[model samples]
Target: MNVLIVHAHHEPRSFNAAMKSLAADLLRGQGHEVVVSDLYAQGFNPVATANDFATRADAEYLVYALEQRHSHGQGTLAADIQVELDRIKWADLIIFNFPIYWFGMPAIMKGWIDRVFVSGYCYGGKRIYDRGGLKGKKAMLCISLGGQRHMFGPGAVHGELATLLQPIQRGMLAYVGLEVLPPFVAYHVPYISEAERRDYLEQYRQHLLGLHQLPALEFPSLDDFDDALRPRNAL
Candidate 1:
């Protein structure tokens, strides 16, 4: 399988960086082709502006999504965005590698998604959820967090980790029609010992090796919703 790892850590010596490298090396050792998009190393632009498009549908006003559609159609999208889009198209699976910030992804990685997953291609109108442009592809989040695992469950200091990730797992990934795999989280990363970090890397290796055995996270199918996108049972 062709795998794409979109790595978003600023420091090359960071644990997230180690995971990214390990994933690429391990996957390649398994005889699978791997591509790593080291966002910071590549100096990816995180800001979205009218500059994303070479030719705009409406030069007078700036509507980001609309311009995405227009530029994608005209083959006039910015070089960086087009490169990422091509990588997404080439991959059978995409792994998002990053350190969770403010309970979310880094701004650069979010911007990568914002610019690369163009409208009318990734999704538009009824072409969403199970029917999205990337329907056959798979994606998973491989994240590191400074918080302890125990602090993130019911009645704990924070809430469920899954709930906290609903926007990414459900809203962005599932909405774009990628089969959402359960994320591999490296918890309490900052405080963990070097031995513990090694253990985490081994765990991540196992996760990559056993990806096919893992069940995808449940999400709403377009079939379950009516024309208005309300649940069929609701109607």
Candidate 2:
């Protein structure tokens, strides 16, 4: 399988980095082609702007989505965005390796998605959710958290992990048609022992090796919705 790891962390020696490194080695050893996008190291531009397009569809206005569709159709996307898009196109599985910041992804990673998952390419019109542009590909998040597991559930301080991750897991990944896998979260990494950290790495290795057979998170399909996008039964 072709695998792409989009790593977003400033510190090279961080636990998130360790997981990213482990994944690359383990996946390569299993004979899978692996690619790593070290966002911070590469200094990837997280900001979306008019400069993304070489030629403007409408010089008078800067509608990002419209510009993206036009540029992509014209084969004129920015060099950086094109590179990331090409990687996404080539990969069967994409693993996002990052540290959860303020209950969400790092700004750079979010920026990567904003630019790369463009309209008319990743999703647009009716081509979202089950019928999204990346429908057949798989995506999973490998995140490290400072909070303990118990602090993130019902009646807890952080509410539910699933709820907190819905924006990325559902709004981004699934919206683009990628099969969303259950995230591998390392809770309280800063407070954990070295031995526990090593154990997490081994667990991650096992997860990657079984990537093909891992169950994806269930989501509502297009068929389940009515013309107005309401659930059929609700309608």
lDDT string, candidate 2, 80-192, tens digits = 99999999999999999999998898999999999999899999888999999998999999999999999999999999999999999999999999999989999999899
lDDT on C-alpha atoms for all candidate structures: 0.94, 0.94
Assess candidate 2 and give its TM-score to the true structure: 0.97
lDDT tens digits, residue span 102-166, model 1: 99989999999888989979998889999998999999999999999899999889899988899
Q: Which stretches of candidate 2 lie over 4 Å from their true place?
A: none
Clashing pairs in 1: none
TM-score of each: 0.98, 0.97
TM-score of model 1 vs. true structure? 0.98
